[model samples]
Target chain A: MEPFRRLAALACPLVEANIDTDQLIPARFMKESRASGYGRFLLHDLRFDAEGAPIAGFILNDPAAADARILVAGRNFGAGSSREAAVYALVDYGVRCVIAPSFGDIFASNAVNNGLLPAVLEEAAFEALTDWMGGAPAELVVDLEARRIAYGGRDAAFSIPDAWRAKLLNGWDDIALTRQHAAAIETFARERLRAFPWVAPRTDGPRGGAQPRSPDAGETRAGGASPQSSDL
Target chain B: MPATLFDKIWDAHEILRDEEGRSLLWIDRHFVHEGSFHAFDTLAERGLSVARPDLTFGIADHYVPTAGRPRIADPKIAGMVERLAGNAARHGVQLFGLDDPRQGIVHVVGPEQGLTLPGLVMVCGDSHTATHGAFGAVAFGIGASEVAHVLATQTLWQTKPKRMRLVVDGRLAAGVTAKDLALHWIAALGADAGRGYAIEYAGPAVEALSMEARLTLCNLSIEGGARCGMVAPDATTLAALRDRPMGPAGADFDAAAADWAALTTDPDAVFDREVTIDARRIAPTVTWGVSPEEALPIDARVPDPAALVSEEAARQMRGALDYMGLAPGQKLTDVAIDRVFIGSCTNARIEDLRAAAAVLKGRRSRVPGIVSPGSTLVKRQAEAEGLDAVFTEAGLEWRDSGCSMCVGMNGDRVPAGERCASTTNRNFRGRQGPGARTHLMSPAMVAAAAVAGRLTDLRDL
Candidate 1:
């Protein structure tokens, strides 16, 4: 993950509200593993026609917006599904920042994890940025550390949680974030184990008392794992 | 201090609160599927074994075909499922692979196996993990990176979400279902109404829902931008889990039930926000546009862009109308569909099957229809009750259990330029397939649509 400090790049204005994850990158394109390149499929359905030709009218295919590194969208962008592939598609397609009035909770979390900045601006500020981009190719500056976005004599401040801001500045994945609270986590586990023993993992064996034993201790089959007849 | 069920679960799982108020929260149960293979790879890269493999469970649902249990022909999907099974084996984690009778959608299998108990904090690699919160748990989806974090440390760093309460009072009209309630709420509140909040569903209407119906409601919480949705445990909840194979028995069941009984919000507790809805006003809702919030009652006409107050709203309305190929003043019931899908974690339970089956008992569908149960158990139960026969007799393809057409990852899809009346959450563009138009509705309404070859109201049917 690269630390996000600042970027000044051409912005593509997509004024449609509720640009969900499915629209960003549909589920069918999520077949390949996370490491595979997803840029080709970013907004695949919307950007291409049935003949596999690029839809020239689409914003991403527009000659003027071809080099956009920032996307200015409407409210509630990324509002659906928890697919991190949405962020992967944007980042792989050279979109480093998305300026919106609001975002889906899970999508925003996934964005931060992938080093993509979801800069939330007020509705008026977001509209201003889009209006400016609609006129001509414009460069938008996003300063994460300063929590501000500026373009064409207009500037606005955004808000992000302190912890997430630190993670974005430090380029820290969740593993590194969790490592900072290792001692506290261990303490909590010990206390919880004693306080709620029933919630612990089922290490005593398979769930039911009458289930047949597995041929190998480590590999268990579903033969005897059906719900009881009475229960059904 | 009085705490809601969410607070009880969160406080019980909190390990530490940092200077920035982010807590290290412990995960009691972690559910994984084929989509989670990347997380396992991350753990291997770090040379870290699963910290608590016993608490983690894996299933092969996402890419597994719902028509048959044949070997997956797509190498990429096959490899992902194989990797999931291999990773689970190496870590001593239990896996329900393609051939397992227990293999099903992870959300359906978890609660069916009694693993998603009340007052536990659960996390899965899928956003619909909030389905488990219907059992009074604090559950939500985590990203792949967070998935890896939990696999390695059995904990996740988090910021507590503000709590909101939704009280739906009164009685639902006949033929209206939990799916309608969820769609109506999303339409009324807009997609981002629950953003940055954890929500609790309460009031007489929610309490009257069966456990499966409650699960259906919570399953769609993600569609509304909520972190999670929960319903407190009551007699109905206890009875639903009474003698499940994985649940407690004898004296243990008694003790557990007592604890669950106390897992309710205190009467005097206050929430960060609250909203009240009249259940009687809800109709059989259907989404007309890309967003779940763009829904209207089945009898309503397509919204006119001219009537919209804001330019942004009108722009979105025009875009949706263009993509969906719809016109203002058009009745939803008059909109023709190419197919019908009755499945997904949202409404593929045995009860949902019965509802659709009853509608299709002696009726033949004018258009093609597919029925995929939520789990193998659900499939077997439907078959035992001859619900599968009814569906097959009515020309609806009765298939095996998995997330069939809901996510379109299993090769089941609606063709381009075709419309479908579906029972799954999310009517987002290309959600079912590329250029596929989806109208979100309940299972019964989907059955009615299959018969009418258009979006038809169940009440009219």
Candidate 2:
């Protein structure tokens, strides 16, 4: 699928600083397969009362804030836990961009890799925007193409490393990237084996012999070679 | 023209530089946990073996079951464990498997076993690898690709990081422990103020802390966007290092101590950024929202979203308020909790357990909770001191050594929509699991919350 690039602005007010990954999707949700809808579970515990009813006083419950999309968070959004599920939850929740005074280092990278726009803005501006959005559908425009955020009578420019941006903008994962470079990688491996013969294991068969079999394909590859290495 | 501790270590480890000017640095040790399985495959695909298996260690954490001895029943998980064992054996790296007596969280085991030491560079796939900085080492977490590189070459290509000095000058107040100080710093510094920095914690407050306390302080360095948090080794460090498994003995002990003592920063060393905190004002803290920095003094009120930085931020605050089910100006203590977790590398030590046990000694908890010992040794020692009985008697489940509910990788998890007061790091929206609300705090504070079945101030309790 082509990457989803439409941007929406969040209408909720600012939360306290240091929103961590644990609170984003929680560890329990990890037990469920990724294919299961993680969206419904997002903020499942935090949004509802003990009786499972939505807390009427919460900002998300206010009708005026409906369709809120952009998230202008307090300082240090995305702390704790290394789960990429937080990114999944945010994206699934329809949050297009997160403008924070700062973000957890690892969490920011995860968000970037997962295609979430984690923008860092000055703290004062973030506070100003929070004051302006009070309980209304404040329009915040996010231009992924230009890496700029516009809203609340102001515009903010940001930067994302081109390498990471390209991955997100194209919806290509690490595996996909490797696949894209497959030919070059194969050539590099062949060349490297020739140059540093000691590093690569020797093969006994003919030069173009049928592709060597891969043993223990389904076996665990934890910290060791596969059990089928004898086949070589 | 200027020399700093960070520069000294960075220079000492530098072997060569790539054409891009990135320094190729030597790695003294590489630690792994269950979560970084992908890195192992990456190394294998490259047709390489661990460069120095003797210096590498593997532990099964992050997903090990906390309440049972049964090799995790989930086939996929079991496969992971088995694969790890096979991988370690094949590579000649020592594996501290789930049932191993020496097994524990990698960070905890490293210090306890004396594997982490002064002037060394430690790397792990887990962000909390900064926990090793208590030993006066340069420690940091690396990406899976970096982990693979370390396994194959025992070296890493690194960019120089900035250095920051967070000096706490005064004595800490009564009831204020290292956990509180870390939370307070994180709260004030906003969790990312030290991004790409190596933080050297100094001054009277840091000097007075024990090695365990220092570990706790350093453990949260990643929370502040720092690669590590380090303290110069002192007499206290020597005392702690002496009894560890790989620690110096006889004449070697004296020699090691001298080297450790010399690792301190020179008096006139400069830092890129400096922030000072008055230790006296620190109080027991607890999280009110999803992040560690979202914390407040135990008695503080929930923050008002209307007071946030931007309308979009305010909007997120609204969503956070909705998710946390909190009202503006509501006292944090009034928030009822369904569970409590007091474990993980953050707060599962004997001291942490003792503090919580003292609080729960004669108290009854209104909520269900778990107190997991960080290691088998810790579990044994706590039971010897009847700490486990104190928790069990207080209605908290005393689990075996494992990561437990801290991240809920194991089966031990709260059901959907349960609010828990946890002593572990991160109170992210659902860190413990889906529909699980976490409020992070100190072990004693978590105990207080458990007893009251709500977010209660430790001092009041």
Candidate 3:
């Protein structure tokens, strides 16, 4: 993940509230393996027509907004599904920051993990940013360490959890963050194992407690695995 | 101290609080599925095995085909399943593959096998992991990075969420189920109402629901923007866990029950926010637009954008209506549907199947429909009670357990531009398929729609 500090980039304003992950990247485009770039499919359905032609009216397709590296959307952006692909699409498409009134909990976390900044602002501040975009190039500066977004001498402050801010400043993914608490985790695991023995991990290979020769042992040749006749 | 149930659980699981007051909380149970194969691969890439494989369980739900899994026609899906199984094997994690009798949706399998217990902190790669919070646990979904984090270290770094209590007083009307309750709340309180808060569902109506129904309610908490939703454990919850395979037994069970009794919110507990709904006011609800908050009662007409409180809200409604191809004044029941789906973690339990079966007992479906049970146990139990025969006779396809048509990443999908009445939690645009319009409803309502070939009120049926 890239380290996010300060960036000044053109902003694309999409004022629709509750912009869900499904709209960010449709399910059809998600079928391909993760290796294939998702940038082409970001907002695929909304950006293209049935004939696969770009819709000129869509904001991203507009010539003026074509180089936008910051996206300004309405409240509750990324509001459905836990798909990190949404963030992948945005980051891959060169979006460095998303300014919104709020975000879906999972989507916000996924954004940080992928080095995309989900900068939250008050609804009025978000509206001010979008309004500014209507007349001129909306180039805004986002300073993560300072917790502020500024444009044309107008400054708006935002708030993020101290931990998330730290992660962004340090360019740390969750794995690295968890590593910092390794000793505490080991101790917690040991204590929890004794406190809740019933919840221990199962070593049973299959239902019968026998390891099968095939990795797909329980799976049938065709229609997948079927229940044992006795159980059925 | 008078702590809410969420606080009680979070405080108990705290390993260490960071300088920022973010706690490294221990994860007692971690559920993974095909979607999490990447996380496992990341762990392997780093040469780190799952820190506590015993605390982790994997299932092949997301990519397994519900109808004759048959080599999973999609190579990508096939690869995911194979990878999930192989990863689980290599990491010493127990996996419930497609053929495993224990296989089902990860959320359903957790509770049915007695793995979900009171006061246990659980995490899953899928968003609906909040479904486990019905057992009084502090459970929520995490992204793949967090999944890898938990795999390498059985703890998650977290900032405590403020608590909210949604109190639903009075009894629900006939034909109303937990799905309706959830939809009602989301509709009343907009989609982002629960943002930054963990919600506790309380009062008479929530307490009256069965464990399965409670799970349905909590499962949709994510839809309302809640970090997680929980119902305090009581005699009802204890009775549900009595003899389960993974649950405590004998004196241990009694001791656990006694411990669970103390898991409720203190009588004078103060919530950061509180909202009360009259359960009697709720009817069988359905979403007519692209978001869950766009829901209305089954008999209600689509909302007029002019009636909205703000121009921005009105514009949003107009856009949603345009995308859904719906008119503002159109009656919900007057809308025709090309298909119906009755399964998902939200409403695919035995009780949900029985409700759908009751509606379809002697009736035939007027359109194509599919019924995928939540888990194999649910599948077998439905068959034992002849619910499968009822569904099959009604012309709905009875398939094996998997998250079919809900996430639509699997082979099962609704064709583009088609309208569907689904029992799934999400109603986002193209959730089932590109350009596939979804109407969220209860299982019985889905059955009613299948028989009517259009959205219909269960009360009228």
Error at B270, model 2, angstroms: 1.7
- Of 1 and 3, which scores higher on lDDT? 3
| Candidate 3 TM-score for chain A | 0.83
Report how far off residue B178 is in candidate 2 (Å): 0.9
DockQ-based ranking: 1, 3, 2
Instruction: Please list the residue runs of candidate 1 whose C-alpha ends up more than 4 Å from where it truly belongs after superposition.
Output: A201-232
What DockQ would you assign to candidate 2?
0.10
TM-score of each: 0.95, 0.75, 0.94
Separate clash counts for every candidate: 0, 46, 3
- lDDT by residue (B335-399, candidate 2, tens digit) is 99998888988888767888888889889999998888877666765665567778999998988
Candidate 1 chain B least-lDDT 10 residues: B242-251
Please give, for residues A1-232, the per-residue lDDT of candidate 1 as tens digits.
8999999888888877888888888887777765678888788888988798999878788899989998888788988887788888999999988888899988898899889998888877766677777645678888998999888787889888898888889897778667777787778878876766567543333333111111122222334333425242
Model 3, A1-232: lDDT tens digits are 6799999989888877888998898765655666778788899888998899999878788889879999888899999878787888898888988989999999999888888889899877777777777734478899999999999889999878888888888897677767877777777777877775655533331332111122122223343233322220
DockQ of all predictions against the true structure, Cα-based? 0.33, 0.10, 0.32
RMSD (CA, Å), each prediction = 4.8, 11.2, 5.0
Q: Of the candidates numbered 1 and 3, which has the greater TM-score value? A: 1
Q: Residue-wise lDDT of candidate 1 within B1-461, one digit each (tens)? A: 98887888898788877787888889999998988877888898989889888789998888888765667777877777888889999999889889887778898888877787898899998999999989999999988888888999999888999999999999789999999999999999988999999999999999999888899999989888897999999987887766555666556677778778889999888899999999999999999998888899999999999998987678778988988999999998899999999999999987888888878889999998799999887776666567777898889899988888999777899887899999999788888888789999999999999989999988987
Local distance difference test, per candidate? 0.85, 0.72, 0.85
